[model samples]
Target: MAVITMIEAQKRSGRFNIYVDGHYAFPVSDSVLVDFRLYKGMEIDKELEGRLTAADDVAKAYNRALDYLSHQLRTEKEVQDKLTTLEIPEDTIEQTLKKLRDFSLVDDAHYAASYVRTMMHTGDKGPRVIRQHLRQKGVGEKVIDDALVLFTPAEQLAVGTAVAQKLAKRYQHNSTRNREQKMRQGLMTRGFGGDAIKAMLDAVDLTPDVDEQHALLAKQGEKLWHRYRALSESERQYKTKQALYRKGFKLDDISQWLADFGESVD
Candidate 1:
């Protein structure tokens, strides 16, 4: 048993240093001091002291969680992980989590839904990538699934078409097929599924005009012609044709370009 000798306020507000028998014992928040009704000359047993400190721990953990959530909405796992990093005891962490949930301050479902809505409005990530990011944040699969329902097929098409159109413009210098292929890859990278990407590709106009196509093919064919210059003429022509074919140029186009290239060289 020990007797309280002093209750002194710490430099930080709302916290106090507890002294027992003329020696510093532990520190607690103002709320804990009030709840436990500690004062100088009050007698306390070790068990009661344990309970007071435990309550203080819960208060600290809960306050820290509130501060963390002040920046943005946080999942329950995020708050739990934050408390764990502070070295809060597991039971204390659990208690803090309960208090937060009781107040509706920390909820995974709310976090996931808000995150998806925010991304849907302002982000380029596809549903799969968004799910991956939410999962990494420790949101549950079911919560993520429910939240992603807000990202409807209609939304996907709208966003994907916009993205695909932008990609087609970026790849406009390539042949029609090559530009379409690049747009497809770009859409996929941005998280659109195959069907969504295909629809978006179909919806966007990637076909270059005849003059643009000819110029693009000629530019690429010239580079290839130079690249294979070291090879025998037959091998060079064969290599150029194969390279242009792989780049989405038709065989007839390749043959005509090669013939025109040879004539121009002569």
Candidate 2:
């Protein structure tokens, strides 16, 4: 580790600039080497000062990634996953993560809370659904529980209520008993819980509700209808009974709904 005192600087070529440190030091890449001695009789070698500068550059890249992340609310796993996908070095990614945590920039807990808040404020999404989303985003159960502060019974019920009302209006045509069951199935599919859905449906007036059960019933009808076409004339009646029964349709309702479609003649 030789320390040289830079004395003067002179231009040697279009790309070469020599730094005179009592003698002459030539720039080779990022490092400077002095071969001639001017102060007494001494020669030395020293590594370039690019090491610290390189550290700074890498730090900036990490900061840039964090900055892009902070421009929006990102889940912790989501950001880390992205950096991993970008092939950022593990050390650099760790350094960036530490800095972000220090600045309170990537709190998974905060993100969970924020996500729940946003969903509740916008529409009738239940806590169960929101929790699943937060968990998928790498938020822990503890953090999600903490974030569930706002989704009280009434709040949750309100969500169920809103969704049920919309469903009722949308499916007002579900005249048969199966209509209610199908709506219940749909709410369950949407991640609303049984208790919430039961409470909501119990509160809702089915009379004014639209026939949401139509699509499901119609889909079942299409399947049974297809099977009815495939059966030979003799087996037609038996197959229609078997198909509609397998489709979970009410024996009487199937007969009633499709009667207008007319039966095939032998």
Candidate 3:
């Protein structure tokens, strides 16, 4: 209980200069204090309790970040995004990522593999689409390629089937030409192989008992394909030349597929 002597309380420009034990104490920034009476000596407890509370708050925030990351695998970008969302400072994020990396908790390689596995099973995606997705997730090219190696031919078939089924359902229309063009573009956009798509297209019976528009379009497309397919050897060669380009087929593959159509190859 120290007696704080207020020796000279000078009324300054906009505040009262508070002196305790003939020495300047903390500033009384509030103007309301001027209304009060101050004598020669006053008692003040200068106990700094805020220091302890501030330290505890800082520690608690860091601990929360650590606990949040312990739950699952996270990419470096994902972890950094989360850290930013949590309002953690950049320095703290660097520290947290380092700590996480040391623990083998935030490895991009492991995360990429797990992501590929999950996407393969539920997302029903091919290598190209999955690679793009992983790239957006901040995975490196080598890691993406490593993950892609796991996609076997059987997996590619499943992915192709999934995308083809979905697209075939939507692109069925009154105009068979429109439906055919839309499906070719759609399946290609979904990263399915042309051969795989051709097989799927051939296998699906577009005509069903459900709707007349679908049956009509299916008949029209079938009629056109048959007409185009049954042309004289020269006419067939001319149209086959354009089919590959229309299909977005690779130049090498296109040249190879139509080699016998109008080529000098014996």
- TM-score for each model: 0.90, 0.64, 0.51
Mind giving the per-residue lDDT tens digits that candidate 1 earns over 45-79? 89999999899999999889989999988888888
Instruction: Provide the overall lDDT of each model, using Cα atoms, as 2-decimal numbers.
Output: 0.87, 0.65, 0.61
> After superposing candidate 3, which stretches have Cα over 4 Å from the reference?
1-62, 70-72, 193-196, 199-266
Among residues 3 or more apart in sequence or in different chains, the pairs in candidate 1 whose N, CA or C atoms overlap within 3 Å are: none
**What would you estimate as the lDDT of candidate 3?**
0.61
> Which clashing pairs does model 2 show?
171-210, 171-211, 171-212, 172-209, 172-210, 172-211, 173-210, 173-211, 174-211
> Per lDDT, what order, best first?
1, 2, 3
Query: What is the C-alpha lDDT profile of model 3 across 1-266, one tens digit per residue?
Result: 55556544347543444565667764432232432333445554555223322333334344566677678766788778877888877766776677667878778988888887887788756677788888888989999899878777677777667766777778654344455667767767766667877876665665533345434433543444466876875675556545534543344544444462335321
Q: Which is the winner by lDDT between candidate 1 and candidate 3?
A: 1
- Assess candidate 2 and give its lDDT: 0.65
User: What is the C-alpha lDDT profile of model 2 across 114-192, one tens digit per residue?
Assistant: 8777877786677777888888888999999999986777777777777887887675554445457777876787677
> What would the TM-score be for candidate 3 when compared with the true structure?
0.51
